[model samples]
Target: MAGGITEMGEPYSPYVGLVYMFNLIVGTGALTMPKAFATAGWAVSLALICILAFMSYMTTTFVIEAMAAANAQLRWKRREQEAVKDSDSSDYSDDEVIVRGRSEPLEARPILSVQRGGSSPDQFDIVERVEMGQMASLFFNKVGVNMFYICLIVYLYGDLAIYAAAVPMSLMEVACGNHSCSAGSVKYNDTDLCWGSVKRKDAYRVFLTIFTLLLGPFTFFNAQKTKYLQILTSVMRWIAFSMMIILALIRIGKGEGQGRPPAASFSGIPNLFGVCVYSFMCQHSLPSLVTPISDKRRVGRLVLADYALILAFYSLLSFTAIFCFAGGDLRDMYTLTFTDSCHALDAAPLRYFLGLFPVFTISTNFPIIAVTLRNNWKSLFHRDGGTYPWVVDRVAFPLITLVPPVVVAFCTHNLESLVGITGAYAGTGIQYIVPASLVLLSRRHLEPALGRGAVNKHRSPFRHTFWVGFVLAWATFCLMFVTANIVLTETKPKN
Candidate 1:
């Protein structure tokens, strides 16, 4: 209300760090991190984390610089204004011309006179403001923004479809266990705790298939209303984090047994890196933090503090997970994996908790993907008159949101595969590539200012180094993961 409503009549509200963090977690981390580590090995995962973090930091700095430049330009122009007094007491005098020329309308006369009077001596202000505004526009408009929107659509729909199918499948597997009609015989490995079903082992495969087919539209619709959806997401994240911690502790205390195989062999270096990346990917929430810290100087400080806290949280969780499941199967790497494998009958509470975590995370994320898609579609077609206005505001939004989940329900009707694919791609783009590119672009454009030491010293070289290195490395990692996923998916035998 304070900021007033826009022409579209929507109220403006500033973003907060918590919201951004929630967005990052639900949109990408919740669904992907577990699977990413599983696929890329810990080392590659860790490399991805470092790269993503660096890129995110860089992007944030650029955003701040861009804002500052624009503001500075405004301030300079405002200061250069020359107050004009009426030379003739009459309102209709030459000095008070209602319209300057035949080509100019009455409304344009004042603005033209102000410029013609040459009231502002500081031309830098105009230049800076123009440049900064253009920069901001570029970030928010342009093909880059469209790319982000498309990426989000792909990620969300893909994930939602997979999860919709995977959840049911995973749940059924856990529920049926030895008594499952599909499972004729159940064999459990000692160290790995891997379970094999002789009959109907492919029961869940149906869900996977359904998930893959419905992924496109489901993700597109889900990405639209990410901003408000984050509130629910935050709660889910904390719950997941808690479940993970408890599961880790339980595994570490009780040795793996009862058909559980040894933890997937950690490629030591790769695993470590993977864990780090998983943790760092959470930092994509940093931008939401920017809006709250109005002062530029304080923004740098806040970012540092935020990163410190993030690192500490990630380190604790990764360490706990690694130590607890030291010799377990990496394929089933989740907070519930330990409980499912070792204490199946006994660890009811942990399993239930873990089960609940995905439900919340997935539900929240589903809406986000839908919202993102709807908004982007509206921006492109509705604004151009290519589509009816009511289509976006009324028909399209609800249809996009509801249709995907329904289709997902018909497909594999599970959440696992949906989460997996969404996590890998959407998570990677939002967390790594977008931020990295923004930083790179900012650095290139603002190089002169940075070189002149015009930026606040405390936020210079160290920050720049982190971002530049981060963008490059993270981009590489994301590309690799995407390629690997495409190759793996394509090469796999079809059911």
Candidate 2:
């Protein structure tokens, strides 16, 4: 019964867990996807997204299997500690000796057949949130764990940089560009004047500075979003997304659509691959999301349902966008596309709301992400039973987390490139490579204690050893292709 409650202080339901996973997977990446879809072309984009969705679902199951294994391992260790205590006590008797018998090194013990038919409590019920970091420690060597943390940290930095650039870019556009429907046809450059003398780029920096000063300090202290605030943001996200989709459909229906995209574009595949990978990410946070579910028996179905719904939503959004607007007109941030004075939307108030939406939503997330990164930094270097100095603990870790992303944001406001690089490299590790490694290693770690036949009710459908090798192999291919694409793009002669 205690396992029914989540760390968020709410009683768990399968439906609630579904909502959390949905929200986690569909964030900033979804906003950037329409532009990538347009560039990549609609036919290829649809097929590729479906494939990515299935791959992502497979990895999701892998993470859930790893979580159950981690839980079982934790329970096994606690039993061992209790046995040692009982053996050391002077009043230990028959009952205590029976308990001590279970403490024999796992290799010498008989194979404990899987529990079933209501004979005993299952040892693998997920009751505790064993974070990916803790799972890494349990299953990986020192080098592996360090590599995991480094990949995670780099991904977080990319996330922070994208947020930093997006907010200011939105502000600069709203402040400098004409909002009247008459000037919607015009496009402005960074060199254009915001007021009289101030350039658009300069205005962007001013807003970025203000944003950093206002929200950056929260990183030094622990910060988390309250439940109500999360609910409010989720509501805003749905409203904004719905408004864009409806407007695009209305324009297409009116026979005013201007889009004429190609059927396929080979050059666009690498960026689209990164965007899809980023959009489907939830593996790293599955422990926090899945452990609290009251009924995990149907969790595999819940994940399937969520992914189906999300894939449909993405298809609808991207299809409407590419059919409604010309490829060149689509902005990297899809919300900004709605803000333009184009025929799709003309209401000043609604346009402004859509344009500034990222500012409202991403600001709330930046502090939470900053704190997460800071904690990961501390975890990477932490020593058993050793304490950090006050300045090192309170000041230094947060500074390292806060500075790098902000500096990257300051240099370029090109969000597409940022998201692409982040998702392609570090995101690949977190989503594909890390989950595969975790499940593989966790199974080996638990086999001696639980025995090979012990059932993990939450084991992945992709249970074959071949699937694990396949995921790692796919991750390697993606990284190499993306890196080569980047190099080729940079070296190609400019026209």
Candidate 3:
């Protein structure tokens, strides 16, 4: 019976689950953080990041509580079906009863009474895996669900675009940059010659073409990363992260650090906000990671520890980077900072490895994101029992998923602005608004089934309604700030 509750995947211990959450939160966004930090000033960036981390953690708890609520709702409904079947077999013997001269059906009573009536907290156990989207559907109206998918689709598109540009940009740098370590720390322009006649941008396009040909087809089918590939990528990610941090610290220690960032820069705040939000994003995927934990009684503690570790890691990486490289010299991708011929790193092979790191990692991720986006598109338009045409399912959905991001990548390779905008708007909806709304609505939805006195053992420490409002308000402020910054910056004179 217990196995029947959580059969979606194999469950692991809470400690292993902690590692998975850590890895999920610290990905490509961390690579972009240093640049944002340098531009925004380390002091301001630190303050904003700390605040955002707390807010993100609050929302993370919200999502987890909602998941438990979702699980409880699912279990209660399943039991209701069982009860109905049994009642039908007994010729409706227990279907109704009289309460104070009013007739009531047996199912009308609190179905979750037994579990919640006890002190064991079994009712709110996260025994089932309910995805964010499923929770949205369960707790939101049709309009709200549509809006949720739209925000998610847009965020995924931005992710695809970032991955699309990053790989080719990495390849172009490794292929076109001077290999003898003789260029002496000069940035290349798009029009610069990669070879005899091909421009660097042209080389980027060529690699993009090759990338599309190889990885784009996976979107048309159900594609997943194998366990071995997951391990390989994880190992490479740690190796690359450790190498960059160590190299940066070595340069800073030698008194060769080229950075003297200002204490604050208001202009850089919006992008920094977006980057921080994006970096701390694990809310949407929490259901998958948390539901598989064999013992979830301490899941909240596990989440706190994971967030603390990630916050420390981000601060370390960004601080080392901002101190090691000059603000102007900082590349949008932090890994690119080590690719140049500089005092910090003199080895040509290591330089090339760092230069091409994104190519290896982002390429592996593009297909998975593309497939995810494709599925979201299907889910958005799916009818209750209707199937799509073969052409639409295989061709149209994949084409829509693969083309827009590639085109966006081709039009501009400004990874910083891309991430900033995506994280500010769509990421805001996912990280803040959606979770807050879900938790609030889920509580309301569960009240009828499990009286107002019922408690969700997995409820957030911020179980107060005020915290939900605070998160929503903060999200609103971030969106407005980011949008205004973009407008003012764009309209400012370009002399």
Candidate 4:
């Protein structure tokens, strides 16, 4: 089948999707995992990360299933409209042909389900591109859609905030802080002066201003991260990762390793959960990523394989860092470890390269993410067939997208807390709860029309109702646990 690959020019091979997913799932969040890993204890971090990865994978399948269902929903809705407009041209055979060719067949034959029988022809047929917002409209009630928008908005805002803070923090660390590998173990306070008179906090704020001035305006225009840019980012990411992993391995081989992470630390599990969930996040973009694959009959298997590779990759990357650097020695930004004291490496150029990795990568992504948030804002307020006012479209939307994150970044440059908060709450909603609910409701909405036996070609592996309940329940518990942890930690007396 030609499917929905036409608009995107040439579709990529299945392996390309594998690579795209890996890159998407392993971003800034991975940089923070080692610290959480060290703090939480190696054993806890390892076990928890594995469990979270599995949970995230499960929800990811939920999203893909929902995306296919959404596509079917859109396809049938359009047909309904067409049928109304051309009532006189209706033919009974046309309905059957469309049903047989495009609609979910009356019996579900999941591609991954263990079956000895032949598969249905239309089982893999919902090939239209349906974004999460469009799916919300089709599947969720008004309140549910609004809640989704709000949750997504919060998540996007947190993302932009984290990005806005990260670039400047890296710049400030590079420009004003001590670079002598000797004092790498000591923590620097924000009140410390830079350039003789400028405080480190002030330096961070200055860089944030510069960051906003330079990249913030991209939010005003409609933009897409091109394939070339993605490739470039991916290359840089691998180079940076390889550099750190190799450096750490060399240090450990030389008996110079500083880290002795404990086997398990219960206290550190919460932050690790947030960071891992954030790192594994790719569900929100599933519709865009999955729909354009050249061959998707095995999309579920493809995603499962991707998640497996990603889990192994993350474990390798984080474990290497935690062992190479002491728990207290690891910085929230893992790149800072290489920069703090470059004596570990003799090459000055390589030292600078490691220190500034986040600056380059995060800077590139900041604008792209800002534009995504801006688009989400527009979608939330959007009316059908309605055009936005000049101020609302051009000015207000971009401002809304660009400001909150900047303000949050301005107040603090703590990358760990920012990532933690974003992932724990908004990330939970987007990655877990929303996907589960969407699939459940989509199944319900689709069943009456497609019938009880209808098979969603892309239905989640957890096709049972209990799995949806489990996901939602887990999300709720995480939210409560994270919230309680934050409150207790903040309110406790300092000894």
Candidate 5:
């Protein structure tokens, strides 16, 4: 549940692997993209999205390669222990046990890759259940592992916060939003009364309370979406995305697109950068996706195709949205824009369906993510074979996982900055810096064992040392840029 080995569900085929990756990569982040694209300009958004997709794909391959390397090292250690016992060369049992107890030596290599006594066909298998967090413990020093966990925990908290705010925000809008198909009515604000003296913000807090009561308990235990539920959510996701795109296209084709987005907007680039980063994020879950492939040979190629499809889908969705509605008219939750009785859509029932899309989809997701965060917290604090007491396990973790995000939602349901900051800082670390570091360190560890010429079947296309450095450098620059932008925005006087 820590984005590690997904043992809760049954194994699936590579075809399912492709679909699962598509679903994982295309998430709530896409909902925020139309507004970001509208802000930054279509051309700028297109180029950055493409480049970031390529960058993400490259890092994905890096992680797979590292997974394979990790498998090889594990295999090598087992083989070494077997040899020591079989040969009876010396009374070195004490030494062997010590070495075996430690994490596999960095330079350990599979016997097959060593070109000697190849007894196992699965020597270089990339499908092993080496989760990202486990890999960090194996390869990274204590500080690195702690830092990785810190970044991941922070990212998951941000995730829960986004979900907490989103579902309630959607509910607040659908319940209190104007539904009379009134033309040219200004959008509702939190200051508006949801009831007699009950402000929209209070309504949001009400829904947030309901959300917590319904879903928060799942955080106390292990929770996984059953196979049927996954199928249902996937179907709902497709319907929501496709409906938005098709409706927008219909409006534009009828010669009513109101958007005249600028060709470029420098001021908008920072947020757009963060949005694209968030949208393309799937690296944290790569092990769970790549580990179950029925056929490992073409995993890289299949991921490339998936990314291409996702990029095209995002472009189509956002382009149609920006053109169908004026940029200034777009909603942070893109579905809300279509939910009102506006010029773009006026069918009452369809409006309710669209307005409630986030409420349904995000509701399904909130538990799974909260459990994931809870598990990550456990993983961070866990010691060797040590378990938490019942009270700590059931009470403390769930409360810690559930409370802060709900607090944030109660304070404000605005998600633009929440999404942007999460993506720019924690998402960047998980997606860009972590993968680059893993592959680089894995390669260095393997050089002595596999020899410089040994070929890794799962090697990244951008396998050169130069590319690794480039990825790290680019990630650093982006982090700095985001930080500076945030600082300036905070300090700048209101105009």
Candidate 6:
């Protein structure tokens, strides 16, 4: 019974199961997928689906190996410490005969039984020492710890910025049709309402400000505890998933063509696919998944399950969005698609249900951004404590996470641009580059342990190397695209 309870505490429960599902859907797919599909089109979107799924699986495998290495190192260090302690207390029995007397004869009695008083104390010392040295020289140095930290920072920043924009956008959509706000100016009912009158830009600014100032702090404080943090993260994940689902469905049913601007170039398909890939880019959270599953076999199974679910979700959403909005001027992506179909006066209970997902997504993502900033600040200063107290940390964390996003909201406040920037840079790095690097590095050093036909049974050396190069090249190209797109499409003049 104790063992059963212990197992429950070790991250194998219904809650974790739901949390993983929610994380995959909301963390990557729900938040950024719409934008990817909007830019990349269905074909590229399909390619992204395959790539992201493969990357996710590879990342999971490497993470398991890294965790196993870390655990082994820790065990080795503890054993060494024990050995050193015993060595310090070493003593020898004074009365023990160095050798039996010659008169006793060769086999007559216990000969030369020089008692060390207790055990040799250094019996396992050599084993412990060797293991510790091997761990430090091999595992710790080679793993992409630094790269993960950098990628996490970038990803979280993008997430916070997008959410900061999205929350106000959602609310503005809600407030425009509310009866009390409308007053007696023009008793506009649901049927009579149009998208023109909504103060979308203003609402977006308000949302951005609130997220930066208010939600940022709240999330920061809550994230201190792992349990609550996980729960909050899980809730946000589901919210993001629901948002993507709703947005995709709305785009499908509405059939595009809502008087929004047309695509500036013939790159919508690429952009859309990028967004789809972004939706499944949950590499930052992969470590959390691996930490829970102890058994190597079980880890493989869980990762496979995660990939299957992600593939199914991405495929369905991409297909529906493309078929529904085909040739209908892919301008403003699905934002216009959503706004056109659901008037301010129309009580979209479905949207409200979906709205919960984005709310959690935006809220949680903001703090993660803040935390990343804090971490970077600490690293630069070589500080031992948290970065909460440092002025540079405070300024950088909030400013990077919030200010540009709020300003963007106040200006153009276009969801497509927000999502595009996020996918192009942050998504590319987090989802593609970092994972590929980790896999390659891990395979290089721990080849025998993580190699095919080995104890762990990972991918072949050639296949692993190919993926590493492939993902890095793809990510680099996306980075270039992001730079070009931003240059070409500067925010429209602020009112």
Scanning candidate 2 in windows of ten residues, the lowest lDDT window is: 1-10
Best by TM-score: 3
Q: lDDT order of candidates, best first?
A: 3, 2, 5, 4, 6, 1
Pitting candidate 3 against candidate 5, the one with the higher TM-score is: 3
Alpha carbon lDDT of each predicted model: 0.46, 0.85, 0.86, 0.79, 0.82, 0.49
Ten consecutive residues with minimal summed lDDT in candidate 1?
Answer: 1-10
Task: Give the TM-scores of the predictions, in the order they appear.
Answer: 0.60, 0.93, 0.94, 0.89, 0.92, 0.66
**Error in Å for residue 91 of model 3:** 2.8
lDDT per residue as tens, model 2, 1-495:
101123423448999999999998888779889899988989999999998899899999998898888778777777666655555573544333333344334334333323223222377778888888888888899999999999999999999999999999999988986778876556778999999899999999999999999999999998978989999889999899999999999999999888887889979989999989889988878877887788888999999999999999999999999999999889999887777655667888898989888999999999988889898888889888999999999999989999999999999998888888888999899999999999999989777766666788888999999999999999999999999998999999999
The deviation in Å at residue 198 for candidate 4 is 2.1
Worst 10 residues of 4 by lDDT: 109-118
Superposed model 1: Cα runs more than 4 Å off = 1-48, 63-136, 139-142, 162-240, 254-288, 294-296, 326-333, 342-347, 384-393, 397-428, 436-495
- Taking every candidate in turn, the Cα RMSD to the unseen true structure, in Å, is 8.7, 3.7, 3.0, 5.9, 3.9, 10.4
Cα-based lDDT at residue 122, candidate 1: 32
Instruction: For candidate 1, write residues 1-495 as lDDT tens digits.
Output: 001111222222233443344345333233334543444444554455555455555555554544444333334334333322332333554444333343333333432133333322232121221222233334445776567656655654564454565454454445434432243334343222223543333444443344434543454333444545556666666776766766566666687422222234342323333333333444233323343333334446555555555554654555455444433333333544533443332445555656556545555555454555565445434343355656556776657755665575564432334444455556566556654555455545433322433442223334555655756575577567556656776799999
Model 4 lDDT tens row, 1-495: 101222334577788888888888888789988888898998888888888989999998888888777666555556555644453354533233233346433234232221213334364364666678777878889999889989988998989888898888888878875665555434677898878799989999999999999998788886677778878878888999988888888898998888899998877777888888899999887776777788887888988898899889889888888888877778898888776665556565776777788888888888877887887777778787999999989999999889889999988888888888899989999999988998899888776655556677777878899999998999999888888888899999999
Better structure of 5 and 6 per TM-score: 5
Which segments of candidate 5 are over 4 A away from where they belong?
1-13, 85-122, 182-186
Cα RMSD for predicted model 5: 3.9
Which candidate, 1 or 3, would have the higher TM-score against the true structure? 3
**Shift of residue 186 alpha carbon in model 4, Å:** 6.9
- Candidate 3 segments exceeding 4 Å error: 1-6, 93-120
Tens-place lDDT per residue, model 5, 113-150, is 34343434366776567888877876788898889988
